[model samples]
Target chain A: MNQQFKDYSQVVSQYIGNLPNDGGDWLVAQRSSAAERFTELGFPHAKLEAWKYTGIEGLLKQGFETLDKSPEFAEHAVLNQFLPEPVAGRLVFVDGVYQADLSTCDAVGITVGNLRSAMAASDRTVLEAIGSLSGVGDHGFAALNLATVHDGAVIRVAAKTSLEQPVELLHMATKSAEGQALRSRHLVMLETGASANLIERYVALDGVAYFNNLVCEISLAQGARLTHQRVQHESPKAYHLSDIHLGLQADARYHGINAAVGAAWSRTVIHNRFLDRGASCELDGIYLAGDGQLTDFHLDVDHAVPHCDSRESFKGILHGAGKAVFDGLIQVREQAQKSQAHLHNANLMLSRQAEIDTKPQLVILADDVQCSHGTTVGQLDPQAVFYLRSRGIDEQLARHLLCLGFASEVIDRFESETLRLQLTEVIRQQVRG
Target chain B: MLTIKNLTANVDSKEILRGVDLDVKAGEVHAIMGPNGSGKSTLAHILSGRDGYEVTGGEILYKGQDLLRLETEERAQQGIFLAMQYPVELPGVNNMTFLRESMNAIRRSRHEAEIDAVSFMKLVREKAASVKFDQKLLKRSVNAGFSGGEKKRNEILQMAMLEPYLAILDETDSGLDIDALRTVADGVNLLRSPERSMIVVTHYQRLLEYIEPDHVHVLAGGRIIRSGGKELALELEAKGYGWLLEEAAA
Candidate 1:
């Protein structure tokens, strides 16, 4: 018997039998099939080509026992530091269970609440959007998340509505359920001509050792614009796996910036598909790993229609025995004429033992497509260090400045000043350690 | 202001500077002319405390202190500057931020108060104008995507900002046109004073036309083959370096 798979299946089956089918039999069917899919796929191993550079053996061996019921927040003030000051329309989720008391939607025009409530109202939009992309049979972790998603976030913006303040979603893993796994599912849909700023953050309380599987599916209609920011800072003993699926229609624009600095081992996969003409997606990310940590970013941008454009830039800074991997793929179909895409991956390795594996793939099948990718891996430039030192900057400060500058190139693109400043400090702290 | 006695250096285990001797007084401008790979850059790098260059046998005295024993930043704090031939590009560090931090570091080392933002901006503007550096470029990354001329001008800007007591220009005019050369030369000349001395290391003589030197020395085969007054540069420019190589052999 595959012990790892059996452990997950047994826990999932027990949880499935306990779930209340209030949303009718459709939701129950979806949950059961998802569990079967995850069991068949099993945990990704090193043998999988896509997971070659990363191994989940240790994470699987941890034996993630499922929690019988959602754990309540332990009423700790520590959650304050993980959130932005003067919170604006923020949703707080602890152990994959949405906390309504801790969450508030300041904006009156936006519809932001928990998925469980929306399911009670028989919200077809919420139900259809939650597991819409999970039927494809890829992404075992995302399938697992769908199988056990008890409560997540549901955000819907009507046509021509604009939100002044960004909506922040905080997912925290508390120490109460140290050995359990938490699954989170989020659905974000914006109608035509709608605009909003969204922030999805993941954090784990100190010393929490759990598995967090999150799936966020987003759809932007024609002429819609969404700026999404994701910040992941899990505890050193926790495991995090996130999948983001974004679908953009004609004239829709999506800008995403992901900053990941915490977690013992984490991987974030972002898949953006442009389904209509004149759509554009811009994605930028920064990942820092120190000591024994491992961080990975896998971005795939697919252009199925013509006149679509995408730009991707992800940077990794590794110190000590840390390891990082960045794989960026831009695929343009044969019918995607006039499709333009650019991808760049740069890594800075501070320690000799640190390793970075970067792969930038650009496949253009159209005749008039413009696609290019560039990857660079190196330590700080000696010439630059000497230049700084020759001007009286100390050796240590000089190195810090260089690394900060490298990481800031991505953070500087953030549109929100509050997030930008906060993330700058976060990056500074990471670089300091 | 600076003295080099039987200074020898090697690069990557290969001896580059066999034995060189030089002396410069305050308020003096000495030019070192040499062929390619004759240790002009190696000498400058060694004085600036660059790594990987072994000082096989050398003694450099700067203001009566042993210069080689100090670290690169320590040497800079002591007022020794080397304007690199190829200025390094820091892609995300703002030029103004780099200049301000560098100036403050040196000032702090000298036990002086750090310059305030207003004063620093004012001072930078004044110095930038001297080099004809655009105010807009100050907001950009240090030397990133800058033209060769802009990079050379940036080096001169740093030199003017630091105000080194003994400045070493390592082929500063290599990639500049006549217009850029004049701008750089003017910036260097503006910094020349009675309390300061300069060593102009160049492969060509065009830079000397703009910033005339008090003394000129011809270096060939890692040794000073000849030394003369200011007119030496003109003669060397007229005759190729081969003539000096033959003269050194003879």
Candidate 2:
């Protein structure tokens, strides 16, 4: 039984047939076209320029099929760590299906609920926003997510409202989905003058091999602001892929951070586009890959309007035989004058067998723009290590301190104190591992 | 407390410290002054057991133990502290953390209990105050973004905190104004005790004016050619090192 030869087209059709028709003909047509696009494009491969460094052969060989029904999970308590004490909202999903009994939505100035339920009432705004951005660039993974996603979060913040707490979405997988595929889709919209903080975390209850594809579409109206943080701590045997798309209007701001501490092979692609003028954004990320794991972060920022600014900083600490890849591209169009954009990628190879491939690409067509990009891949500074050792710190402890210090610059940028401290512990464990 | 006999060392396959000899007793301060390329700093590094300097000849004895046989940390644990000529900046390790860890390392080697955080904080603050060092900077990264004078002052602070038996200050007055030099000298002067010895390595006699060394030696060609009392420093300051280098060669 060859895994790669199994037919996946039937699974796509079956997923589409199982979806309710309450969304009218428009959603049906959108899903049909998305399935067609996925079938045509298929899974991304290393031959593709955008994914030249990462190989998806292992993912394709898993022979994944959409999990039509939620499977039984005995470890319902696995979502405890992700559920902070004083959160504005919490949504727990297992295998692309919302677990209603385990979720709570008590936030003010916001409407948070299951995506499928929100879409069933023919919410034209929800459908239009989801359909417009899901498969915009013909990305195969995004198309698959749009075509097969069954349940996720639908959050809308009202205008001129500010939330004091963060909304968290916990996406977990159980061992029952060993050979199945999970696709989750999220739509977050912020109206004019609205502000909120959103956190999305991924975890796995068991160390089983599965394919998880996620797609999130975000829209920020004029004068809106959103702080988004994404954490991926999947099982070491899991294959994870996420596509995040963000659209910013005039004077809108988006501060995003994507961090990954555990995964066999995980990739997060973030695409941010400035649709109006005076929009600014800060995109920063950190990845700690150990024990032969692989992590990648791909970012693309488009400055289509004038007076927009974008800053990106990414760092990776790779130990064991782990490997990491970072590719960031900031593009400034002809009319986007005074666009200040800087992109940087730094990697600390903690072991001799660890590897990293990083590139910071800048494409500026405007003459009055300030754009720069740089990449650094090196081991910890030997001089700094010796400095600590000379102070009587052992060589191993010195190395650990240097590695942690190297990672602190990126970790300290998170505004949320709780998340920052949690990620600090995660980084410490990775360094010591 | 310290003795080096015909100590020959090489750096990068080139002979740097060739047949150097020096001796210092307890409670005494020895000042080794020399021109450039005279291996003044090399001797300091050799005593502190820094890597990349191969000691090809001779031996160093501290308290009847072979100092060259120990590792850098081991030498540090045995109460040999080297205040670097150019201190390395560590961007992530906090100053107080480094100080506490160093102190614990020394204590652990001596089979003593490690100090707790509260007591360690008190100790560091006291030592920092004695050196006139700003305690607020201790919360920042170790010597990161510190000025030259501040780095020198930090070295003195470490000396005060550790209270080593043999303290070697290598060019601690370099790149410092008169005021900063006085502060650093005062810090070093306060650390002097009957049970401790110090080696002041410098290029000029200005620092000696404040610390008042007991013995002075002119180092030329990796060897101490002239050894005398504290008056030798005044003579060398008046005549400069040109005559000493020529006389040593002759």
Query: On residues A1-433, what C-alpha lDDT tens digit does candidate 1 reach at each position?
Result: 2876777787778878877765443467778888889887887777887799988877887877666566655666535644455534888888777788878876766888988788778888877776665452375777677787767898888899888778888888777758878777788999999998898877776778888877888999998999998888888888888888999999999999998888889999999989789999999999988887889999989999999999998998998898998989889999999999999999998888898988899888899988888999989988889999998999988988899889878988876676678777766666642
Candidate 2, A235-311: lDDT as tens digits: 88988998888899999999998788877999999988899999988998899887768898999899999999999
lDDT of 1: 0.86
| lDDT per residue as tens, model 2, B102-171 | 9998899899999999999888988999999998899998899999999999999998988899999999
Residue pairs of candidate 1 with colliding backbone atoms: none
RMSD of 1: 2.8
Each model's lDDT: 0.86, 0.85
Model 2 RMSD to the real structure? 2.6
In model 1, where do residues sit more than 4 Å from their true spots? A21-26, A68-79, A82-88, A205-207, A426-433, B111-113, B235-247
The candidate maximizing lDDT is 1
Largest TM-score belongs to which candidate?
2
TM-score of each: 0.92, 0.93
**Worst 10 contiguous positions by lDDT, candidate 2 chain A:** A1-10
